[model samples]
Target: MPFSVPPYRLSQAIRDKCKRLHVFVQAFTLPSCWYPHRIRILAPHPVRNKCGNAVRIKTPKTGSAVPTLADVARHANVSTATVSRCLNSPDQVVGETRKRVLKAVQDLGYAPNFSARALAAKRTKTIGAVIPTMDNSIFARGIQAFQEELGRHGFTLLIASSAYREDLEEEQIRTLAARGADALLLIGYHRNRAVYDMLTARNLPVLVAWAYHADAPQMSIGFDNVTAMAGLARLAIGKGHRRLGFISAPGATNDRARDRVAGVRRAMREAGLRDTDLSLVETQYGIETGEAAFREIMTSATPPTVVLCGNDVLAVGALRAAKEMGLRVPQDVSITGFDDIELAMLAEPPLTTVHVPHREMGRRAAGMLVQILTGQGRPDNVELKTDIRIRQTLGPPPPER
Candidate 1:
C-alpha cells in the first residue's frame, strides 16, 4: 500500500530552520531518489514526490537518504512499535529495550516525527504568541522571558508580529491556532468579538498580557494600566507640574494607551484642573512621531510644564525633541514615560518612568498557560506591581513658571 500522509503545513520548528536555509518549500512526493513518503520539498534545486501530504525536506549534504524510524528499529533488532514506545512513552517499555532503542536512535541520527507524535498525544507542546510589533524593544525583554520559561517546560514558542493592526492580528491568531498552538499569549484585551468565541469553540487556552482586568472575564497577567499610570501621574503632579501634555500611541485599538491617558486626566481632575487644560496628541509609535508631537505640544500658546508619554519609545523621542529644541529636561520641562524599557535608562537624562515587571509577568503568564494546558490549574489572571522609577527626567516646573 502507498504511504499515507497527514494534512496541512510543516511545524513552526521545521519552517524556522527552512527560513535560515532559504530553502523553497513545495508540496511533492518522495522520489525513488529518496524515501517513499509525501513531503514538502525544501530543495535548493528541485525534486518531486508522489506522496499526498507534506513533510520538511532537509536532504543530507552527502546525498544519503534521511534515517527513518524503521532504520532505528532495524538497527536495534526490534519492532517499530517498540521503537515508537521507547521514543514517545519510555515507561511503557522495558528498561533494557528502551536503552537499546535509544542507542539505535542515536546511532542512526533519527528524530521522532513531530506531527506523528502530536497526533498520538493530541498535544504539540508548542505555544504561540501574536505581539503588536517587533520593530521596537519594548516587548523584547518580556517576550524573551516568556520564551525562556516555556523552554524550561519543554515547550517551543512561535511568534508572529501584527504591527498594531487589529485585522492582521486576528489573521495571525487564526494562523497560529491552525498551526498547532496548544495555547496562545496575546496582548491587551481589545480583540474582536469573534476571536474569543473561536478560541473558546476550539477549546484553546488563551491568555491576555500587558493589562490586568480582574473584573473583566478574561485570563490576563499584568499590571492594571489605569492604576499604575495614575500613580505616575500623581507623582508628576505632586512635583508641581500644573501644565501637563500627553503624547500617546493611537488609542483607537489600544486600551492600554487610553487607560494611561485616562490615569493622567484623573490625577489632573482630582487636582482641580479641567481635563481641557491637558493637551493630548495621538501619534503612531515611533521616535520621529514623538519628536514632532512634542514640538507641536510645546509650541502652543502656553506649553506644558511636563509631557507624559504613553510608553518608553515615545518618551525617548520626546527626550530627543527636548534636547534638539534647546530645552533641558526636568528644568525647562519635565518628561515622564511608561514601561521603563532599556531605552528609558539610556536617555540622556535617565527617564523617570513607570517600571513594569516585564520578566515576572512573562514568567507568570507562561506558568498560567502551562497549568491550563497540562490540567494542573484553570485559566486565571495574575496582577503584577508597577513601580514609579524616580530618576533625572522628573522634577518641579521651571523656577520662573
Candidate 2:
C-alpha cells in the first residue's frame, strides 16, 4: 500500500491544504482562542462518524475538542452552509470568508470523510491500467510517467498486472470498472472480441498501447512494431550476418512479439534465406528462459551468426548465456533486441536495440483518454516512432573459427 501511494500524492495534498491556510489567515483575524499553537487536528472519533452526525476536532495542547460543522461555523463566526462552502468550494466563497473558513479548518485540523466526499462528487477521479507484468522494468518507467501526468490533472492511477493472462486481465478490468474507474488502459489489441464488446456495450473507453495497427478495432497509442523490427533486421542482414536465430515471447497472445518475428522473417526471405535457415524459439518472457533458449540455439551443429530477440529482456538473457559459454558478443556471435528498456543500456555489451518512446507514449495515452472522456476528441489512433540504436552488441559475422 505504501508503494501504491507515490510521493507526488502526499506533496500535492499538503500543498493544497497550505494554500487554503494562507488564504484563511489573510481573510480575517481569528481570536486568540483559535490560534494554531493552541489548536491541534485530531483523527476522526467514532462518535462523530456515527449517529447524530457529529464532527470531532481535538486540541491536545488545550485539552479540548470542538466537533461538527456547527463548531466550525461558530468558531469562524459564519453560518454552517458558509463553512461547508469554504471547505468544498472555496472559490465561490468571498475571499475574506473563504480565508476565515480555511483558518477554521487549519486551526481545528478538520478533515472530511473520504467516502462522503466521493458520494457528493458523483465521480471517483481515478483511472485504471491493466498491464502484462509489473515485476520488470519494461513498463515501470512508462507507467510512472503516466501516473505523474494523471496526478497533474488531479486523478489517481490504479495499476494491476495480468501476468500476461487475459482471463485475469478481464477480471481486473471488471473490478476496476466496478470500483468506478472513469477510463481504462489496455496493452495491445490482441484481447478477446468479447472483452472489446463488453467495454463497447457499457460505453467504457479503452486505449491500447505497446503495439499498433492501422485497421484493427481499438484506439492505439504506440509505434508500428512490425516495421520497427523489420528495419533492425534489414540492418543486421546488411552487415552480412546470414545465419540468424530468434528468441521471442509467446506469439499466441503477444502482438508485439509476433510482429517482431514477422519482421525478421520478412527480412530473411527478402535476402533469399530459406524458412528452415533461421531457427525460431518462443520462450517465456524472462531472462532465464531466454538464456535456456540461447544455449539451445548455440549448441546446434550450425549455430547462428546473430540472435535477434523480441525484447531487451530476452536479449539480456542471450547475452548472459553467451558470457557463460565463453563467447564474445558481436565477435563470436552478434545479438540485438527490441523495447530499449533501461536494462538494455545496462547490459554488458550495451544492447543494440530499438528505442521506443515509452514515456512519451504514456503521457500521450493519458492525455488522449482524458480528451475523449471530456468530449473534446474522438478515440483516434496516434502512432509514435521508434529508433534503431546500433551499439556494441551487433557487428558483422566473425571469420570462420
Q: What count of clashes does model 2 give?
A: 2
Top candidate by lDDT: 1
How well is each residue in 3-64 modelled by candidate 2, as lDDT tens digits? 24433455655545543553455345533324342112211122222244543333236455
* Candidates' C-alpha lDDT: 0.84, 0.82
Question: Cα lDDT of model 1 overall?
Answer: 0.84
- The digit string of per-residue lDDT tens for model 1 on 1-401 reads 12133322556565455444332333333432343133334322233333523334444455777899899999999999888777655667898998999999898899867898799989998999999999767578789999988876767899999999999999999999999899999999998999999999999889999998889788889888989888888888898888899998899999999998889888888898888779999999998999999999999998899999999888889999999999998889999889888889888899999999888888888889888888887865688898999899999999763
What's model 2's overall lDDT? 0.82
Model 1 regions more than 4 Å off: 1-107
TM-score of each: 0.76, 0.74
Candidate 1 least-lDDT 10 residues: 36-45
RMSD (Å) of each candidate, 1 decimal? 14.0, 15.7
Off by over 4 Å in 2: 1-121
